[model samples]
Target: MTTVSEAILSRRSIRSFLDKPVPPDLISKIITQAARAPSGGNLQPWYVDIVTEDSHKRLLDLIQTKIASNPTGETKHYDFYPSDLPDKYTNRRRATGAGLYEAMGIAYDDKEARWDAMKLNWAFFGAPVGLFFSIDKFMGKNQWCHLGMLMQNISLLAIENGLATCMQEAWAVYSDTMHEFLNLPEERIFYCGMALGYEDKNAPVNKFITKRENITEFVSFID
Candidate 1:
């Protein structure tokens, strides 16, 4: 049996994907299992939009138009990350970004290339399925945190089945476009998106790994 430890240790954010479709049954099973994730008061407060048709093409079209108008356009609904981030969080974000760019041979000073690279998010990073997460507007940050737990659950379940995934905040950049395209009700807001499929194990970007803080830095135990 695969222990929980084995599953946790092996899960990773897979960015490069092969161009193969994930069967509906498999995708259904994955979501069904991940829904087992615990939520406070069982409000669940989450909804997912699965993209598999011309709908994805329409979404890409809308996003492209927005990006053309403002390459660093304001995210349509909520800001994905803090604008004035603290040192610890900022460093972690920069290091991984640098690592990813370096892997793709993008120069440190290349703004256009970096933004070009970011455009891949709308393409689902070449994955066959794109899943967008949404949450009710009234839910507090605690509920959003619960939604994250649910997302992680989905990613881990994918890993256990030899599939791969990348959870993306980039999708929120086009939330208004998405909301219109998906015809989602006004009460829900974009929380995030995810690309799910088999990894292109040979891709150099898949090899990038950012350092994480040690337990001593972020953990406390009073025993």
Candidate 2:
């Protein structure tokens, strides 16, 4: 039998995708099955919005037009990382970013090329479908963690079904815009987004493999 670990190991944060389409039914199946992910008190304080068809094109067009003049995008306070983030975490982030740029043949000093690459996040990396995740603003940290499990579940299920996904926290910066665009209520907070589709095997950026810390660095055992 194919093990869950097999699916987990095969999954990658795909950056570039082919121009093919993913069937809506498959998308439905993935979302439905991901519900098996557990939550505290089963609060299920998460919400996801799928964008495709005409809506997806409209969203890209809107963002492209907005970015043409205001490249900085809508400004807001984002706490994705801690203000006093330690060097250990920051160093890892820097290394991963450097590796990604290296894989794409982009120099560390090539600011324009790097921006071009980061801008692809808003483009869903050319995936056929984009998914936005949100949580109730009233929820606490535990609920946020629960929402994350939902995201992880969806990614693994995608892998099991021959698709790839990128969980994009970059979208947190555009939560206001996305909220207005999606007509969501003020009681909820748009958290992040995801790009879903088949992987582009030939894309250099998609081939970059991020390094993971050894289990010994995080795991603790007692006698």
Candidate with maximal lDDT: 2
- Which numbered prediction scores highest in TM-score against the true structure? 2
Q: List the lowest-lDDT window of 10 residues for candidate 2.
A: 69-78
lDDT of 2: 0.89
TM-score of each: 0.93, 0.96
Cα lDDT tens digits, model 2, 1-223, are 4479998887778999988899999999999999778998888888999999889999999877767877886765367788888899999989999999999999988999999999999999999899999888889989999889999999999988888999998877777789999998998888899999999999998888888889999999988
> Clash totals for all models, in order?
0, 0
Candidate 2: give the clashing pairs: none
C-alpha RMSD of each candidate structure in angstroms: 1.6, 1.2
**Lowest lDDT 10-residue stretch of candidate 1:** 71-80
RMSD to native, candidate 1: 1.6
Q: Candidate 1, residues 1-223: lDDT per residue as tens digits?
A: 5567877877777778998888889989989998888899998877988987576677777788888887765656875678999998988888888989999889868998988888998788888889999988989999998888889888988888878899888877767777877788898887778999999999988888767688999899999
